[model samples]
Target: MWVLVFFDLPTETRTERKVAARFRKNLLDDGFAMFQFSIYMRFCASRENASVHIRRTKNNLPKKGKVCVMQITDKQFGMMELFHGQKEVEPEQPSQQLELF
Candidate 1:
């Protein structure tokens, strides 16, 4: 599963870079990859991993800003590709079917 996070905050010319740096550091610490400015992407093996990242981001944010987080399954990513006219190929199924005779 992959998670996407977005956030908007008051424009602080001086602190923008600093804040962004801190945010990136925190996300990296939480095992997230930087997808874009104010956005993060993360792959988790379990829901618990996702939750931990969410909680940490929320806790580490500055006092005077707004943030939003979204979690999307691999299916959602495929849908995004479809919008761009990229069809996703499905993997082949096993040829042998198991059944009790």
Candidate 2:
């Protein structure tokens, strides 16, 4: 699963930079890659991992700043197929057994 995080915040003061740097460091530590300014992407093993990353990122941001996190599976991207012509795709069925189990 890939998680995309978009951060939108005002950088009016040095304090803002310090806060942003902390968030960036935390993201890098968690295996996130910088997709763009204030945006990051990460490959997570599970929804729980994505949630934890989002929570940590949110905690690192300034109180006034805002963050958006979106998680999508590879199947979802394949269904969109934006580069190619749009086609109807059958929804994927859930696995009968958990991978961990």
Candidate 3:
């Protein structure tokens, strides 16, 4: 499972910029990696685990911007095509996650 967070936060003022930076930091601290400037993604062992991160992301959302959270299966994510200029490139692999019972 993958939990993808997309956000567009206001950064017009110093305070707003600080708030946006803090939000990104929180996402990173919670194990999400930057997929784009405004997109962060994390791999989870299960749907339940993905839900937990989604909740955490919701809890940290800024008061003045748009935020969207979505989940995708590994197969769906794999079908995505990435490109740099005119050349195609492979997506970076997600790190292996180990679960202990």
Candidate 4:
């Protein structure tokens, strides 16, 4: 599963800037990679794992901003189409193989 996080946070005031920075840091600390500006993505081994990360993201939401988070299966994410200007770009690659204990 893929946990997609998209946020638009206010950066007008110093405090807002700090908040936005902290949010981005938190996402990185949780293993999310920057898919684009203000957008982060993480891969989970299963739906349960994705849910846990989603909950963590929700818990650390900033005070003032728009945040949208959703989960999609790996197959769904794989089907995404990408383009860079007129040239077509390849979609993002999935994470490393899952580990089994």
lDDT of each residue in 57-94, candidate 4, tens digit only: 99999989999998998899888887888988887777
Model 3 Cα lDDT, one tens digit per residue, 50-70: 989999998998899999999
Residue pair clashes in candidate 4: none
In the range 4-94, model 1's lDDT, one tens digit per residue, is 7787766667686577667768878876766557777776555886787788888888655677888777566545532224756552221
For residue 82, give model 1's deviation from the true position in Å.
9.0
- The RMSD of every model to the true structure, in order and in angstroms, is 9.2, 7.0, 1.4, 1.8
Residue-level lDDT tens digits of model 2 in 1-101: 67878887667899877777877788888778886678888766678967887788666766767888888896773474222247654533332333463
Give the top-scoring candidate (TM-score): 3
Please report, in order, the local distance difference test score of every candidate based on alpha carbons: 0.68, 0.71, 0.92, 0.91
User: What TM-score should be assigned to candidate 3?
Assistant: 0.93
Flag regions of model 3 displaced more than 4 Å.
Answer: 99-101
Of 3 and 4, which scores higher on lDDT? 3
Q: Which parts of model 1 have CA positions greater than 4 angstroms off?
A: 11-16, 82-101
Best-fitting candidate, measured by lDDT? Answer: 3
Q: Please identify which of the two predictions, 1 or 3, would achieve the higher lDDT against the true structure.
A: 3
Alpha carbon lDDT at 74, candidate 1 = 59
